[model samples]
Target: MKRIAPAAERNKDPILEVLRPLLRDGATVLEIASGSGQHVIHFASVLPAVTFQPTDVDADARRSIEAYRAETGAKNILPSLALDAASDTWPVHSADAVVCINMIHISPWSCCEGLFRGAARILPAGGALFLYGPYRFFGVFTAPSNEAFDASLKAQNPAWGVRDTDQLLALAAETGFAHEETVPMPANNHCLVFRRL
Candidate 1:
């Protein structure tokens, strides 16, 4: 089945703009929590020289990723794999860069911790880890819309909510990553970039 994520449709281009310069040609990019596979297909198409490895924990998400890859005929995209950020062992051991979009806030905080832990093990020193989504700054919401969104997320699951960027940075540091840059995106979201230390 081909599923659609409206947010993916809206944000793909903007995300690509940032990614274009960051990821080099012939590099492999591991995309975590690749829901609906929309973003990876788009990116693979746009960055033909780069290989995209998409992964998700959900069976449906994996199917959708394969569906989108088949539909797009993107040769650069590999078969979707089952990957959970919190797992002790990942299916793949290394990648040139790692990307996680709109994932941390929707999952438990432990997932974020696991993501960093796994990323630290997989990425080489100076490898980049990119994160995209809404996040609180210094324990305060950047906008009212983000605050409302956080509230809604928490309502759905108390463990899920917009995370504080400072806290995330601290966690990343513990896992041997350094926060590098933060770029503002559309709809009050942000793209955070980190480097393996």
Candidate 2:
């Protein structure tokens, strides 16, 4: 059965707008934590030349991705894979770019560390790693809503909360990536673009 994420539906277009200029023809994009498969399908439909490889840690999410792929018959979407960001080994060997949306804030810090490490291993020099989510910068929350959301996330799981941008930049640097730019989105969320160096 297909599942829908309202957040994914709402943010897809804005995310695509940021991705449009970065991604090139025939680029292989590996998406981490592809929750409902909504974003991948939408991106693939618009960017037919770029192949999207969607992965999720949960089986249900993978099923939803496959369902969306079947419904859309999108040729650029590869079969969804079961991938855990915290794992040292990844199923795919390489990609031109890696995209992770709404994941860092919800997972443990170790997962974020592993994400950078794995991305660095798979992406060649100059490869892009795009991250989208609400974030804190130098101990400041961008919005009151984000502050509240962070509190709620921690209340749910102590490990989960909005991450700090500076910390992520440091981690990226340690993992052979350079912080390129951060684009603010509609909500308090931001799109962080990094390049493998």
Candidate 3:
């Protein structure tokens, strides 16, 4: 059976609303960790001018993304590629924008650090790097659900937990990407946008 991430269904449109204005026309958008490929097909179908490049390190996930691309007949969506956000050498070195959804909390913290370095390397001046997921702002915002989510992530992997936005900003700044904006999303989440400085 095919898998589904409920959050994808929930947030894709809201994200698209915010992304519509932020994304430049005819720009190339690289989506890291394109888990089920649902968002790529939907985004590509909706935003025809912006090219969507979906990527992930997992072979199975890549196949899933490819399958969706073929099934949906999305011409604007590029072929899926193997891209581990923790790597310094991405297959494609240049993109107008890079996006990652729901990855930072599930993967090791090093993945976020690598994402900053990679975004810094690939994005041009004024290019955007977007991240969508739950975040704790400076160790504040003590919602019970968020606390439970954090505990669950830690239980699964010692290295995994929802990130703190201030810490993330520091890392992004270190990698030459400055914090630009933050958009609140449904279900205890946020869309953090940064730009290459």
Candidate 4:
């Protein structure tokens, strides 16, 4: 059965708006932590020219992704791969760009480190990595809501909480990526774009 994620549904359009100008036709986009698979379905429907490879660490999420692909009959959406951001090796070899939405804050900080390390290995020069989530700026929360969210996350798991934007950029720099842009999103989230150098 295909599970639904309300958050994915709400944020898909806003994410697409940013992706439209950045993505080129025929490029392969690898989506990390494709939770309910709703975002990939919506993106693939609109950007038919781009191939979408969705992956998740959870088996159920992959099933949901496969189900979404079946329901949509979208040719550009490929089969979901098993991938854990904290792993040193990724199953897929290469990609023109990567998209990870609402993942890092819910996972251990090591996941973010591994994500950038894996991205650096697979992406060629000038490739893009797009991330979406709420984050603190200069050790301060962007909004009160985000602060509460961060607190809740940390309460659940000490390793899980919204990361600092400056720390994230520094991590990316260590992995050979340069911070390109940060676009504000609805509900106090931000979309961060990076270029592999």
Q: Model 3 TM-score? A: 0.97
Per-model root-mean-square deviation over C-alphas: 0.7, 0.5, 1.1, 0.6
Summarize candidate 3's per-residue lDDT along 1-197 as a digit string, tens digits: 23477888888999888777878779999999999998888888888889999999999888888888878888899998999999988998799999999999999988999898998999999999999988999797547798899999999999999899999999988999888889988888899999898
Q: Each prediction's TM-score against the native? A: 0.98, 0.99, 0.97, 0.99
Across 50-132, the per-residue lDDT of candidate 2 in tens digits comes to 99999999999999999999999999999999999999999999999999999999999999999999999999999999999
**Which window of ten consecutive residues has the lowest lDDT sum in model 4?**
18-27
Instruction: Show model 3 residue runs off by greater than 4 Å.
Output: none
For residues 113-135, write the lDDT of model 4, one tens digit per residue.
99999999889899999999999
Model 2 stretches with alpha carbons more than 4 Å out: none
Inter-residue clash pairs, candidate 2: none
Q: Residue 108: error of model 1 in Å?
A: 0.5
- Cα displacement (Å) at residue 35, model 1: 0.3
